[model samples]
Target chain A: MTAEKLQVAFTDILKAHQRISPYIHKTPVFKNSKINDLVHRELYFKAENLQKTGSFKARGALNAVLQLKEKQTNLKGVVTHSSGNHGQATAWAARTTGLQCSIVVPSYSPAVKMEAIKEYGAELVECGPLPTDRNAACEKIAAEKKYEMIPPFDHYHVIAGQGTIAVEFLEAVPNLDAILVPISGGGMIAGIAVAAKHIKPNIKVYAVEPEGKILEKSLRAEEMLWPNPPQYLNTIADGIRLQQTGHLTWPFLLQLVEKEVFTVNNEEIIKAMKFVFQRMKLVIEAASGAAVAAAMSDQLQKLDKKIQHIGVILCGGNVDIDKLPWF
Target chain B: MTAEKLQVAFTDILKAHQRISPYIHKTPVFKNSKINDLVHRELYFKAENLQKTGSFKARGALNAVLQLKEKQTNLKGVVTHSSGNHGQATAWAARTTGLQCSIVVPSYSPAVKMEAIKEYGAELVECGPLPTDRNAACEKIAAEKKYEMIPPFDHYHVIAGQGTIAVEFLEAVPNLDAILVPISGGGMIAGIAVAAKHIKPNIKVYAVEPEGKILEKSLRAEEMLWPNPPQYLNTIADGIRLQQTGHLTWPFLLQLVEKEVFTVNNEEIIKAMKFVFQRMKLVIEAASGAAVAAAMSDQLQKLDKKIQHIGVILCGGNVDIDKLPWF
Candidate 1:
């Protein structure tokens, strides 16, 4: 897909915001003077970690489900394959909107996450841990039950729904010079970058990833790159461990995101998570820590000194205390 | 002091709110339907854990300091003896208002807390952990340096300051049938009870305390009771291990607070803490968990069925991660 053809407009985000307004929280923006002093730049944290379902995934899920409800008069339900925040979000959105939803999770998925999905009243389908197995299970469920499948990050509606976060952030901090977002399947960054740049053309959007992810290599090559998952996946930031970016999201990234992708290692991510927990009194997951780590890294020191106001998305706070890295 | 003579008026709380408005945050009130279902009551949580200095102590400390600044022209400084939230709040209030402050902490105070006090630019005075030693050190500092002492609780201004929390709570959740507060020196509860009753004369105000504390005994006797701390203090809630309530605060508690004081064991407090951490995604200390435990306990089942909306004060979030009870 061409960049112009695949790009999400600001209008789509506005519509998504309006449609999902009742079901979602306009999450708070927080600032800490101590963090500002440590990073040598003013930081505005868009705290989607405190969002409904404990992540920004709620916005996209709600938007997709609502859109489905509007288009289909005889909608059976929705099916999605995810074992993380997206799964919980889809289940929550479905329950809130009075729809039957099925979540396909790998057999080895964390019991806590599976329990949360069950608590949200979603049917649970178990498959092998491999992505192909999960996808096959989801396809089978959709084919058998005639359930509409909500893609996690690649669909235009999902990207547009996620883009609503940038709309809120920009409204809260109108003069932010840049925004740093952790990239997984590229849905969040793709949406945020397109919306932010549309609103403020000169504002920079930087993608942050775990050190082992292929996003940086893909961004540099201006093409999709999927390294073997076993060889390259060793980071503790489980949320952004996807092997490659989505096709629909890649064009938005190419058109809207900055050229260089910021990367942080597992140790730095853990340190940042601990710092945010202790100093900021927030229980942010490691995936959110990746963006924070990049913001505090020396790599940002080379940016224009005049780029003083930086915004970071605290993506989620759905961590299992027993599995904490520090523990 | 007689109850009438020591009473804190609602006007005093209104004044304190105005005086400290510029300093402290009007902390957010949060509600989770899942938690509400588990507790069998609609719960509205006043998030003082997100307040300045990560506790509602900021309200009392700022109010007391501001009152001093208003009354005294040549205020040399202020002195307080505390090893917990009160000390940090006093330090933060003093630094924010450009006043010299000294905190007399026990030598056994946590290093993380001591470091925070120093970071707030307050003079640190180390003393023995015994109450007598801490009081003596505070008195010496007050006498030699002419520093006016800001008692942690039990002062008229301090109670008035803490009372401001009730005002905000009532404003946010106007028809709350009951409010549960963790009792330490009785300042926070005393203030809240006075303000809540003044605002809605029939609102039930419950005091929560750790098991074995003398608060329940003292409330039942309708007078001050100073049981030996070493004999009765065996709870994990270190923040509320006070031997007795203050002279000024006791009168307010007797006259304004509800008759029965709710007590929770250390085990129950830890369970509540873990539940809040997992469900609410909040990092609350043990003291805050006391109120949550009381709300979730069967004790509240005896309350009038008309009492539907319950408000709980999440008093603080200053737990030492390294020493977490679960960890």
Candidate 2:
């Protein structure tokens, strides 16, 4: 995707924001005095963790389903693969439209997530560990059943939906110096960067990633960072353990995002989670923790201090209590 | 307190809301479809747990301090007694005014809470567990130091301030059938009952308490029920283990409240916490859990079937993560 194409993506996202205004929550932005004092930056948290399905995934998922209105008459249903928040969002979106949907999940996924997905009346297809295998299984099922494959972060509609966060944030606080987002499949940050850059070209966009998995590296290198298998992959922030970015979202992010900063280990993530709970009194998942961790890091401290206003995307709040890393 | 007096209390609360509008948050209201289905009531949760200082006590404390217009000229400082939310609120209130303040905390108070109180730059005075003793100590210190005592719930200004929740809730969701609130010192519920009843005379006010606590007995017996020694008691809902209701608040509550309900044991509280965590995806402490537990009971479910809009006050969010009794 070219810079011009990314600009067009911002236009699409802004339009989606207007279109989905009725259905979606215009989730609030919260300022933390303690966080600002500690980070030495004026932080405005875009609280998408408080979004309808406990994640910004809802925006993207809803955007995808709504965009299918042109194809709604001939649509059989929706199909996707997700380990967590995306699956729930897809399920919720399907139920909202009264569409039959099937979500393929890895067998090792948390029971609570599976329950949430099933509770939304979406059919669950459990598969083995490999991410590629799960996608392949979802693709096979989609082909057979003629269900629309709503790729979690790759689809243009999904990017457009997630991009609305930037639109809302910019509208709420227009002088943002930078926005930090947790990147997994790249859909969220990709959309956000495009919208933010279009509105304010100087607003630096930073994607936060976990230490081991680096979609940030892949986006910068402009090639797949391959052979980086999930080696002892364990983090409390389960939302962003993706091995690869989506083909559609990757190029878009590469063109727009300024840099990708990886947070410290799981210990830091858990510590950040506890910090959020104690200071802000908000329940955010590990993915949100990763963003906070990045923002508070020494690496970002100087840039954060230089900025007049900074925004951090609190991406989700769907934390499983039983498996809470702190517990 | 007469119905007319309660109406006056609400009028004061409205004024307090105006005074504190820029400082306080009109926290969001959320509904859980699954929990609502289980309880068979359209449960509207006013999320004051997300309020500043993680409790509704902020309202009363701030209001009390703000009402010190005459004393402002001679204001040496403020004094309050609490090992929990009230202490934090007082500390926060004092900080807002950039005034010196002292908090009398029981010896058994959690370090986390004490740390928070200190973080607000309030002077910490640890006293014996008994409220009478603490009050006496606070009085002695106040007399010696010329500091004004800010009684947590007993004061008129505090109750009026706390009553702001009911004022906001009624305005946000008018025609609510009932309000379920967790009772401790009774300031929160007393204020709420007074305001809610004034607005909607038929509005049922239910106060939820820990089973072993005295609020339930006091409300039922139509008299004061004091703890054996009137000392701090051990309970999961540390924030609500008040030995006695405020004399000022009890009369207000006795006149306006419809009923007081009790939730048995820490297990029930934990179960309620789990319900909020999993179904509602909101963080509620044990105090809030008591209200939820009462609202979910079989007895409450048998109430007016037409009672579609029942609002539950999640009054606080401050829970010691270390002592979170998930086990």
Q: Residue A147 lDDT in model 1?
A: 90
What would the C-alpha RMSD of candidate 2 be, to one decimal place? Answer: 2.5
DockQ of each: 0.62, 0.53
Cα lDDT tens digits, model 2, B109-139, are: 7788899999899999999966687889899
- Clash pairs for candidate 1: none
User: Of the candidates shown, which would achieve the greatest TM-score relative to the real structure?
Assistant: 1
In candidate 1, position A81 carries an lDDT of: 97
The alpha-carbon lDDT assigned to residue B309 of candidate 2 equals 90
Residue B255 miss distance in model 2 (angstroms): 1.4
Q: Write the per-residue lDDT of candidate 1 for residues B1-327, one digit (tens) a residue.
A: 444665578899999999999888888888888888886789999888888888999999999999999989788799999878999999999998889999999998889999988989999999996888888999999999998899999798999999999999999999999999998888999999889998899899999988777577777887666754423267788788765777778888888788788899988899888877777777788899999999889888888889999999999998887778987
Q: How many backbone clashes does candidate 2 have?
A: 0
- What are the root-mean-square deviations of the candidates from the true structure over C-alphas? 1.8, 2.5
